[model samples]
Target: MPEVFTAYVRIVDGFNRRVGRIVMYGIFVLMGILLYSSMSKTMFLPAHWTLEMAQFVMAGYYLLGGAYSLQLDSHVRMDLLYGRWSPKTKAVVDVVTILMLFVYLFFLLYGGVSSTAYALQYSETSYSSWSPYMAPVKIVMVIGIALMFLQATSILIKDIAVAIGRPLP
Candidate 1:
């Protein structure tokens, strides 16, 4: 692989790793929120925001962790044939599939950005009791999707290198 492609993979991988590690702690935040909700309901006036906040945190956790999961190859796959394939064969197949992933991510990112814009422009709020502004979560979603897209691109580069018998380290 060329220096530029190798550098791009390194940078994207490093950034996604850092983001994933930081986002992992969000699970604890979610647990704390749920705990507080339970305590408040029994001992005091229930907070109106707990459920929605938990949902937002969970969405952040899942979406933000996606690229890291991909990096680790931890996402579920139908390994019926994949596990038996040789390394180069796997790389060849991955390149093709990752192209499809790019298309999906492109559409997802476009919609996320559009929805985020609408949220910001209209000051959109959830139709709930707490009625929190939607922009913050929407922004997080966009960031997560963009990160996943970058990570997918990095994977594609690496796969291409492998397929060409010039694998990057």
Candidate 2:
């Protein structure tokens, strides 16, 4: 069972890393597009799609990178007290906190899927001057929530092993 959990963690972590790198590049592209749009507005023609497109890229960046950030333990955490705990104590704390994380992710996944479905069903748009379809980003959000939830599970397994003095694979 420990080996199986380890394999699962490896796969989830790998997926997060892959998605995170892609999103990192996507953010860079969004930056470049925004920059070009800014310069063009002062010099020649303003690109209307630049803002909308950048938003799309940013949404992807945020959604796809969430699991990766969690995997790296990079989320905002109050470390003053937590940093001083022993490994087993930290694992116990993690297991307790993860329940709340799981609950939040559960709601996000539920809401995101409903929103994405509605958007796709009605061909929803932003109603902005440079409006774009909303379904794609909503779908990405759902995917990201699922990824984060999976990563949380993976971490929980490791924490359990640590707390129990089991050698993690």
Candidate 3:
């Protein structure tokens, strides 16, 4: 592979690693906040924003973790047949499958970007008592999908190189 392409893949991997760790770390914060909110509500001093805050954090956690999951090959899949395939065969299958996934991701990323823009434009908020701004959440969705696609592209490149006679860097 070219030096530039190698650098790009390494950068994508590093980005996912950093994002994954940050999101993982935030889970502790989420837990603490949730506990506080539950206790407050039990004591008749409800933190109305807590539930919504948790939702935002959880959504971000899952979305941002997607690329990391893919990178680590930890994403859920029914791999009964796939597990039996040889490495080159797996690469071939992955190449085709990643193309199909990209088709879906294109629409999701497009919608996410458009929705995020709309939210930002209108300063949209959820229709709830705690109605925090929706832009930040929507922005996370856009960013997450984009990152997944980026990771997928990196994987696809490596798969292609391996599927062929070339050795991957």
Best TM-score goes to which candidate?
1
Number of the predicted model whose lDDT against the real structure is largest: 1
Candidate numbers sorted by TM-score from highest down? 1, 3, 2
Instruction: Return the clash pairs for model 3, or none.
Output: none
Give the per-residue lDDT digits (tens) of candidate 1, residues 1-169.
7799999999999999999999999999999999999999999999999999999999999899999988888888999999999889999999999999999999999999999999999999999999999999999999999999999999999999999998999
For model 1, which pairs clash?
Answer: none
TM-score of each: 0.98, 0.94, 0.94
On residues 1-169, what C-alpha lDDT tens digit does candidate 3 reach at each position? 8887778889998999888878888788789889989899889879889988988988888888889988898987889999999899999998999999899889999999999999999999999998899999999988999999999998888888779857466
Residue 106 shift from truth in candidate 1, angstroms: 0.7
Name the lDDT value of residue 124 in candidate 1. 100
Please rank every candidate by lDDT, starting with the best: 1, 3, 2
Best of the two (1, 2) by TM-score? 1
Model 2 C-alpha lDDT per residue in residues 104-150, reported as the tens digit of each score: 99998999999999999999999888788899888888998898999
